[model samples]
Target chain A: MVVDIAPMIVLGMVILTSLAFDFTNGFHDTANAMATSIATGALKPKAAVSLSAILNLVGAFLSVEVALTVTNSVIKIQDSTGAPNPALTADGGSALLLIVLSGLIGAILWNLLTWLLGLPSSSSHALFGGLIGATIAGLGFSAVKWVGTGAKLDGVVGKVILPALLSPVIASLVAMTGTWLIYRITKTVAEKFRNDGFRWGQIGSASLISLAHGMNDAQKTMGIITLALIASGQWHDLTAVPLWVKGACAMAIAMGTYIGGWRIIRTLGKGLVEIDSPQGLAADSASAATIIVSSHLGFALSTTHVATGSIIGTGLGRKGASVRWGVALRMLVAWLITLPSAALVAALTWGIGHLVGGLAGAFVVFAILLVAAGYMLWHSRKNPVGHHNVTDEWEASPEGLAPELPKEVVR
Target chain B: MSQILLALQAAGQVLLAAVILGAGLPAMFSLGMRALAYGNGGSAEVEVEAQPHVLGKVLAYICFGVVIIAVMLGISWIVGTGMGYKLSFEHFLPVFRKK
Candidate 1:
């Protein structure tokens, strides 16, 4: 019974950490769905987030292809080498639980850090990176299916990395063309006329994008929790996601969305581009299409990248509007770092958790996670970004160079 | 590299489809606005905020109707396939699956 108790406790901790990761994912990506609508005043900030939250709840029921991809791609649930199992696995199911717990811990911290910096990195990649890092620390390179099954490159490279590169490009192209066409077609119309009509269109497109986001992102948490169940010896196969799991994940994400990630919204909506109604509509349309289509293709593309790219594309499509390459460069750097940084943290947490042993180790790491999260929360208070002040003027360096920066680089 | 090519091909399909539906819907809405200008079949100089001509109003409704249908199809596709039993396909969109 004592032997069973430790694994049970670790499993419970893993569930909670997975939920925490889902919560961060909620707030982090809300901007992907609603930022443009809010920026253009098509939807009030509170109403925008509230609508996104409800749609995300409805969207969670959309599909399981991504979840299946995550489970099969990231970690080997059962070894097939015909060799003796490790002592940890042989002793009990605790080893798998520990890996997942450490991975979720890593993902949650990365989510918090990126959220603090207001950088909209890929939460999907963060989650995958955490799992990969923890698997590496726990089991070695052989455990990860790098080249994928049957000598094809359809695993992480096919699903996560390649899609990451292509999604933003596709979104940008679509958005740019959309913006140019909208402008050209409506050039004869009054500015107020076109702008007013597009505002209502922007709301619809933004809502669809939010629904698409829910369909894509909430599935990640579901996959991780399913992994937990399998690793804990509760579920035997990578099967259908149970109903209760779906409800819990959907609710967690909706709650988080309602809370809203105002800082990141400010970054995407205001900092990246001074979005007009048409640009907002174009961006949202691009995001909805890219996300929906990518998920349909079984690729876990980050909605953040798509939204950012669409915003940039709109700026480029319009005459005399400048893309803030400095901010864009910063965002790119953050995206590059997201996977490895999350992995490093996951690895360290995994090592620390094991060194102390059993439930106590998981508890210690959870406490550390709470402290790290709390500190980030407090640190953000100093900057104080919210719906009220999210539309304030963008300072290129946050240092406010006093009206000299725009002529410094922009055309 | 072949895997990369395969992924690229799928991306091309996504781009095309997105353009037709994603970008196209907003363009339809724009066209709807434009069509509303000729409700009286006069010059296309009617102010957008002004009252619309009946024929132009019907044309606007047709454009919006196409947009609504597209959105509904997208949702049903998500719902039918996402619940994991209504449809199955080896790639992208799905073919009907019984049970």
Candidate 2:
């Protein structure tokens, strides 16, 4: 009997790539929960990220949901029971492994590129787009779940596209109402009292978002890692993720949060709007409420869209405040293309991996992902936006999304 | 069309709940701060003539209490959902049932 090691090698690559994706996901989304708080000075930049990181760790562990079928929304790789198709399991599961590997590479590369550009694109959308693209390349276009049977919300149109369009609008309305009411009710209160009180409120609401984010985002990575495990025949239980996988995923996300994606955070906190403590409190509350409510209703939406919408809503609600339409327009463009852009990259990656074939193909894709990520990291260093300058005042320049260099640095 | 309709339905529910909790909680908190200001009187409000009132302080705490309870319920809901349970308002009070 001859034993093949190709699937095992590909499986290892998938796990590593999935964790890398999770890490990017953590830092990429820290802005969604903490940007307003940081902007309002409700929490110092370091303290805000630390608190968010800790809460995310706690949140990751709290999730006990069987999310193994997470990919069902966008692709048909797995059945409702979360098991990989038997057809794809032949030859040590290399077929399924290649697809998963290429998909993860697509997600990670897109995430890094967006982070470099300081765009708050949806991490979930990128992940789904990558998977969709890779599946199309490997299993034909029919493998993608563009729409469901209409019994309930499932598939790309129902789960991803529709929610992307609707969530922001819903979040905006809720936040606008909240912001207007908050300002109205506290009109006569002393400036000192009002600022102090709303700052506390911002902290509380932002904490809720971070906790919820941990439970939501980490589970996606956990599901992917488990799927890879099952594909390689290393794990049998479809309903429960291995304990080590959970622990590793939780740590990856928490560490990523602690590192903080200062570039994207700066965009959300400073570029989009001029946020005060009251607006911050309102925006965070709206985001938290919309996310929790929608998820409970089984209508999954990206936290990025909801947070961005809430921020814009706060601007609209305030009498003198106005949104920077240029910044807003840029974000809209990013959101519109996130799916297709990630999909294109993933499809291309799948092509390259398929051409090379077997374990060597997986290594080639992984190497490309690393090189792309490194280039983005290097480029980001040119205009480093760390905790030190994350809350710097916003100034529009010819270089869009680039913050004005700190006064001390310029001097 | 059905997908759109179903999404609209879900969005409607989310919007309604978001308004009630999202806007409502912050409003309540603002009201509490206002009440606290009224209670503290001097330097707590822009009006110099305002006087401290015991009743205002009590009212402020009550508002804060309600806001805190709502947040607690939100947290509980997240935890409940994770544990394969659903938090439902059966008789105007939340109860957890198997999902």
Candidate 3:
């Protein structure tokens, strides 16, 4: 029996697309860990992302619960009716590959789009929505378990939807309490001393967040890639992810984080609220707590949501601090749209893959993905936001993001 | 559904830990700064970097020591679990185990 090259080609495509999504995930969510630190001068912007990158790499080694949740939770790759006969196995495997590839494409594209818009949306949601959409397209709606029974949460509602709805609220409340307390307890402290002291505190809190982000986000890509491997019959009966997969996912995410997403960092650090050193320490500490606990429990809470909520909470908690409610509302709308928009992208991608036929179809979809990504990269050059301008004051719709420029330049 | 309640309870646990550990650390740091003020640097106005008073300095160290312990516990919980060891806070000392 000659080995089929088509499946191999499909698997290679799956790995590549998955890594691309992981890379986007790295940069897109870097702000969640490092933004406040950068904005508050806890660390320099380049230094912040670099430190976050290193911690994330270290964090990636610390947890696999989220990865397990992602891999086994979403799609049913096998024929449950009976043991896999050759034809049935082939059909199921190929269809699963198509689903994963389209899902990754949808996720990566959505990540880049949101990055371009300076929206710190959830990369995890984009990933979930894409996979669910692809599964619906390929194996019909039955492939997705909307809700799972018992304490084991392996369904969309249990693992994905509920957390999305609740995490921001919980995160905000925790941050608000923390922020309010930090100021209350230190009410008599000198302004300069408070600022200087909290800036030092931020280093510890911010490092925890980076480690937690790595602990949480890297495993998500690991889970999806491992799922693809299992569907392709490479693992046979292997339940655990291989060491190489872990290393690759860690590297992909770390490299992406090191590159950074400056626009999102700008928006998160300076856009939502005028962050000060005290608020920065409070927000980062709250985010770290929420993320670590949730990751421990295997609830894949979005670090983006938590960070954004924590920033806004600091505004609510601190006296005389102004929260940009308009920006907050805009972010809420983006959060709501994340699921449906990513689903639409995944569905369209799956449709394209279906229309093209076999390996050629996969290749065509990959080519389109590359071109779209290239366009986004080219488009971002217009008003390139990087480490230099990342801490600029927040200007809402002014010439050249004037408000977001640092006070010295804005003056 | 029960899922909502369970999720709520889980959220509550995180919130509690967040208040005690996350928010607590920064506040403790602030207290450390305040204690340093109480020491040789009596005034908050000038910004006391040296913190020369022995008692204020010692109190500041205690406050920071508590925060550092909390941080070490947090990291151990994360990194420990990765190596198949579960670290849970119990009475007095922590319980660490291989799962």
TM-score of chain B of each: 0.69, 0.87, 0.77
Clashing pairs in 2: none
lDDT of 1 by residue, A74-101 (tens): 5564444211134445434678778878
Candidates in order have lDDT scores of 0.77, 0.91, 0.80
What would the per-residue lDDT of candidate 2 be over residues A134-193, giving only the tens digit for each residue?
999999999999998848998999999999999999999999999999999999999888
lDDT of 3 at A155: 73
Query: In what order do the candidates fall by lDDT, top score first?
Result: 2, 3, 1
Q: Which candidate is the best by lDDT?
A: 2
| Model 3 chain A: worst 10 consecutive residues (lDDT sum) | A402-411
Which candidate number maximizes DockQ? 2
Q: Which stretches of candidate 2 lie over 4 Å from their true place?
A: A396-411, B88-99
Which lDDT tens digits does candidate 2 get at residues B1-99? 899999999999999999999999999999999999999998999997899999999999999999999999889989988888988998889999998
Model 2's CAPRI class is high
- The numbered model that scores best in TM-score is 2
DockQ for every prediction shown: 0.45, 0.87, 0.55
TM per prediction? 0.89, 0.96, 0.92
Q: Candidate 3: list runs displaced more than 4 Å.
A: A64-69, A78-92, A152-154, A396-399, A402-411, B40-52, B88-91
> For candidate 2, what is the DockQ?
0.87
Q: How well is each residue in A9-80 modelled by candidate 3, as lDDT tens digits?
A: 888899989888989999998999899999988899999999999999998876654334353455555433
Task: Write down the TM-score for model 3.
Answer: 0.92
